[model samples]
Target: MASTPAPTSRRRTGATRERQSTHEGFLVHKSGRWIKISAALAAALILLYIFVPLPPHHFGSSWLGYTLGTVGALLILWLTALGMRKRAITPGRWSLKAWTSAHVWLGVLLIVIGTLHSGFAFGWNVHTLAWALMMIVIVSGIFGVTAYATLPRALSANRYDAEGAITEKQMVEALRSLDRQLHDAAQPLDRECAILVDHSLEQDPFTGSIINRLTGRYPGDATREAASELRRLRAHRPRVADDPLDKVDALLTRKEAMLARLRRHLRIKGWLQAWLYVHVPMTFALIAALSAHIVSVFFYW
Candidate 1:
């Protein structure tokens, strides 16, 4: 005779299952605590901006304006430290996940803080330049956040097939295997057909412009063109069993399918990386403009 499990054991097993099923993305880390804090900070700044009296033209001279400017500057510096934090992984209250959540929400808070600090002043000066650059950095950050949150699922889906998930190395090996098979299969093909197959084999799968990678459009794809031309030539030939062109055509079609999956993987991976090229450079530029703005203000005052 066997004994049944206790009720407490059953409840514990269910709880463990529940925990395993719940996934917490960076956006919703700690149940969106950072989002709530950011909202509160922005609201406080807005209230201060409304209640505190200042000269109509006061942009940086007033105490409140200077205070807001200081806060915004410190926030920008802290947000920029996230890149450094990524290299050193740690756990606890200030984990990387919490840092990222705060980075995103607090970076958004800058729009209100910077605007209030400027006092609605705009002109053809370094002050305005800093503001514009800040806007660009924030916008690019938003795009990056969106990409990270969404595109990862797409990348994962791209790697999966009926059998299992394919790794990058496996993708490369699969293509090489297909190319070798193609090489052997093309031997009995006619001279013109052989040339086309050779072109497909020799062409590099990874060579493409950034635009082509991001857009997943390779207009001059050698493999695709070769497959199309072979099919066209095959159309005019009478149907025959074990024809060499038939084997070659089928191999080309498989290679095309593999190439498409590889390119899609590259496209998603490219999108994941492309935003940093704009965001990182613009961040440094913003810092430079901010330094100039600060210097000119104190120099004149």
Candidate 2:
């Protein structure tokens, strides 16, 4: 008979528990079958809506094919709502991933069924406008899905820390180190202005909303302003031949490069974020358009 030894350390036991929990959380579990079933049902419904004939189905005046068309349109609206509801929350069992998959495929279904529901009828009217809006909504949703799939993970990775929190603290600490070096070097460079310029760059001339970050259209005339200060300070002073000061400038340049990279990483993070402005607004507009279309169908019929 043999008995296995247990984990000898509390840390090891805790780590094992954490891994087990994460593995359970990430398991395929029940979603695969449910997703397949939903996809199949949605596909079948789309096909039936497009091809099936219905009579005594008054759109507004004639309760014939229009009746079945209304059903399909409502179904799409319902599916789209599921996506909207899931937007503000984390992806759980009907997670963002599932909602996105459903939104994309169902949107494709909308194109086929919505067009059929219209019976090839389109004119320059509010009715047609709504259909146009739905198309825009669906396209923007694809952008949303793409952004979520790609950017967030990268942003977390660029933090260079595994806990998944991207902190501005790293940038602050880097700048502080650069400032200390710049201060010690400035006195030797023949004036303090050179050091001040270095300080200002570390301060990052940019700030505020997502657009400003994405555009890199930083505020203030820092470059010209700093150069002006340098000109004033250097006017009559003999050029310093200190190798140590030159080395300081070189070190500052390296710090500048690091700051630029942080900004670039922030800019990429901004692009991933800003598209949602278009995606969300367009979705709201689609609901409005689809609603108008539904109303018009009943009103005209």
Candidate 3:
């Protein structure tokens, strides 16, 4: 029989292989130690640039500014690439979270870099428009960041998951369940009850624009039609006075809550979706403007 490996030897080999296989994250400063070192270096560099006066302005006087601008451009391009990627978007590390952090801090650094680039000079020109556009892009980016960073947490916290993310089928099922409950609870006198419940769940998602959502103005032809149907039904079958009606009333309350929850969830997601409509196209416009500014500054100057 062949000799078997010792347990300790096998364990040692496995541990060594495991350590070797693990990949460090981007920039390769995998541990907290590297984070501390990187932070110290960044702080030191900033302090050096701030306090240590340099020689007279020259060809590369704004070298650091150019570097920062290039970096920012690369980041914007990278974000665009991310958009192009059809795979699922994720939150942290090499993902939107990491991109966002880069965006925030690098943007903060841009203030330093861009100002130094101008040598604090400003005039009415294409260059000024580019700068203005940069500021606008940055502001919009800030808004995008703020909107996404907080709203997801808010959406999670505010949403009721007892039913756990109701869908169209679920809404229909809930209505059916209510209908079943209503059979015993609803009086023969209660008018057109099922129709009202159906209308409530059947509200279409794409009913109006962002403004309509903001104002809760869901009213439209469909809504008006539904309301009219409900009214016509209710008039013919007079209100029922029965104790079992209490259970029907309670079922109505539950269904309403579920419908409301679903609508609110869809609405909030819609808001998040709408922000990109402004943020992305503006970024493209900014890139065009920035390119024009760069060319004019170098060629015309």
Candidate 4:
């Protein structure tokens, strides 16, 4: 009788699959029903603006203009309510996700409503100022949506390494470990090489301003400078198997690479947050302008 074949072990792919997230973000919520609804609403408003008869040389004082203005004003109030609605978490049909989805799509719809309400009559007045503020808010919101959709993946990819995903704390710990290793490795080197290592170690990876964070440009990166200088110093020197400078150079190169990754992460994160700095403040300005527009309209009437 033939001997029984050995049992084959199955390769577990669960860890690989578990690493990826399948979460549907708020923008794509409910198969983008809100997007469809908003598109339809915008289309209808445009048709009304085009087909509906208005008096010759008419302005925003027409009945259709008043209707669109009313709708636009109500939409603005509802859009603003999201700031408060987001604070309270609720489940089911009217969930925060649903509200966010509606907020985004309906906010886009405001562009059509607002433009038609303006009757294409732009001038340097409170009305035009209100429209300008609304456009600013809408554009900032568009940036926010794009950032939310794309930056998260970039952020996750930046955090991953051959050792898999790392936490913020782990990034700092790894840098510290590399620094300690560089310090130990530089001990046997001459004073010049030791100074290079010291310079690399003393540099802070997170010392850049907001502009540096956004641009990912650290002009004074000591680790990078040290690595370049060590490479040049080693160019003419004969290779030694146990050269202390070689180890320090290699460690400095690694520290520089790690700092680059951190800076890239910061850049992506800065973009993710920078829009809010404009969106929130501009929203308040839009509200104030809207209030003035409304008051001026009634005050003159």
TM-score of 1: 0.92
lDDT of 3 by residue, 127-160 (tens): 5666666666667666766767677765675454
- Alpha-carbon runs more than 4 Å astray in model 3: 1-79, 84-104, 119-124, 157-169, 172-206, 214-240, 243-252
Model 3, TM vs. native: 0.56
Residue 82 shift from truth in candidate 2, angstroms: 4.7
- Clashing residue pairs in all predictions, respectively, total 0, 8, 0, 0
Best by lDDT: 1
Model 2 spans with C-alpha error above 4 angstroms: 1-69, 72-104, 161-166, 190-203, 207-212, 215-244
lDDT of 4: 0.87
Cα RMSD of all models vs. native, in order, equals 2.7, 6.9, 7.9, 6.6
What TM-score would every model get versus the actual structure? 0.92, 0.63, 0.56, 0.88
- Candidates 1 and 4 compared: the better one by TM-score is 1
> Order of all candidates by lDDT, from best down to worst?
1, 4, 2, 3
Query: How far in Å is the alpha carbon of 187 misplaced in model 4?
Result: 2.9
In candidate 4, stretches whose alpha carbon ends up further than 4 angstroms from where it belongs are 1-23, 56-58
CA lDDT, every model vs. true structure: 0.92, 0.61, 0.57, 0.87
Cα displacement (Å) at residue 164, model 2: 12
lDDT, residue 282, model 4: 91
lDDT of 2 by residue, 115-140 (tens): 65555557897767876776776677
Among the numbered candidates, top TM-score falls to 1
